[model samples]
Target: METINARSWVERFIKTVVDQAGELTELDRRAGDGDYGTNLRSALRRVEANLAGVASDAPDAVFTAVSDGFLNTGGTSGPLFGMWFREFTRSPELTTAALAEAAAGGVAVVQRLGKAEVGHKTMVDAMVPAAEALTAAAGRDEPLAEAVRAAASAAHTGAASTESLLAKRGRASYVGENARGVVDPGALTVALFFDAAS
Candidate 1:
């Protein structure tokens, strides 16, 4: 199997997020502060601009660079995502199992910091499912790309499911039942990340 370098992964993620920025903003407007896309776009732009200075072959170093960029960006999502990427520094390899473990570690950090769980109508809704899918694929000894594809598919489904769930966390929770029927932008963003990896 061909190994995907960190640079390729980062590039794909940035491109996907930038291309879908407008849609993400619209999703946020329906249930959030309407600035999720703008915040993510700005953060990603910084990541892209600094990517050349990062070590392309070292996943940990690349993730560290990405974490710093996101952490410096001004937004709730930025810090949360930065923490998630920071955890990726512990990943030992780019294989399916390693990636799944890294993703689960990132989810744990998010849960600890955000205090959100599945069915909370937050990014955890998507992230948890994606990590689970990746784990299952890894257990089956699937290729890294296939495992990532499974994660992407699960993330999309999980993000979509949030539309029917009442918000239980974040600013959207303040809207109570009215938040139902509008997808969580954070969850959608997590899904997009896995999709780009695939």
Candidate 2:
């Protein structure tokens, strides 16, 4: 399968993120700081402005615009998401191999900078699973749409799993037992992005 439509994919991502900002923020209010949804929405606004000047459908150009918004946005999760989006700019195309590589690379980078691991009740939980799913799909020579769906499903499941775990990373860790039963906002954001892709 070929790569996804660069502009279309990111466009869907922005719409979904914006549409769910309230829920995202609510999740953060329960688990971490209450500003995640606001910060994310602000970053998406920046993305909108950035996208306005984009005349190309090329993955590199489109993804770069998307990355710049998050990279420039304030807040911990925003910048980490920026860096994750930045990984997509590494390859010119979002083919199965490239997509898998970018997701894995983004996860590694986020883990390094955030000092997060799977079971941390953070975005890393969803991100790792998504990347793994993409990698496995690529290995199996799965079609792009199928691979994307698998990745999305993995991400959603990973995000949902966070509700049962106590936080071990990020601000959510500070609230102790209160964070339990609340989904990780960052993880949910990751799930939302993958869902947008599929």
Candidate 3:
């Protein structure tokens, strides 16, 4: 079995977002405030800074840093992401079963707090699919990489589906018809997170 490195996973997620911040912001600009990228980057910066002080490779410690950064950020997406990452900190081990549980926990908290369902065209869309994929993968005793890959695939598909959905929640909802062609940045971010885990 491959040991999932929490620090490495976080580093990859940070890099992926940093490289694609402009694209994410552009998506937000089309349907919502153009601050999604900026807020996400700021939170990532905090995560990076916090990571410097965490000498341990434990999943909980690294995820706590991730959670803290997002929680401190100012935005609806930030807080939701913060709570989601916080769920991951519940288990020190990053085993497949633990990932499934964390994903389910994260989805529950995000849904409860955001009040967004799968068809609501929010982060919950991608989050729900990713969690389901992780659960299925865990049930099959799949390898960590395979599980993450499945999650990423599901998340990406869910994010893509958002392009055709008329937003029912968040800033996009206010725009009505304009948001139809644009993908939800939050959903895309969820997809990126799962991809990083791979």
Highest TM-score: which candidate? 3
Error of 3 at 195 (Å): 0.8
- 55-107 in candidate 2: lDDT tens per residue? 98888888889899999888898889999988989887678788899999999
Candidate 3 segments whose C-alpha is farther than 4 A from its true place:
none
Candidate with the larger lDDT of 2 and 3: 3
Estimate the overall C-alpha local distance difference test score of candidate 3.
0.94
Worst 10 residues of 2 by lDDT: 1-10
TM-score, candidate number 1: 0.94
Cα-based lDDT at residue 136, candidate 2: 100
**How many clashing pairs does model 2 include?**
0
What lDDT tens digits, residue by residue, belong to model 1 across residues 1-198? 856677778889889888889988987787878888888988888887778776555778778778888998886778999998887777746888888888899899999999999999999999999999988998999998889889989999999999999998887888787788998988988888877765
In model 2, which residue pairs have backbone atoms overlapping below 3 Å? none
| Cand. 2 TM to true fold | 0.97
Give per-residue lDDT, candidate 3, residue 19: 99
- Order of candidates by lDDT, top first? 3, 2, 1
Q: After superposing candidate 2, which stretches have Cα over 4 Å from the reference?
A: 1-3
Backbone clashes in model 3, listed as residue pairs: none
The clash count for each model shown is 0, 0, 0
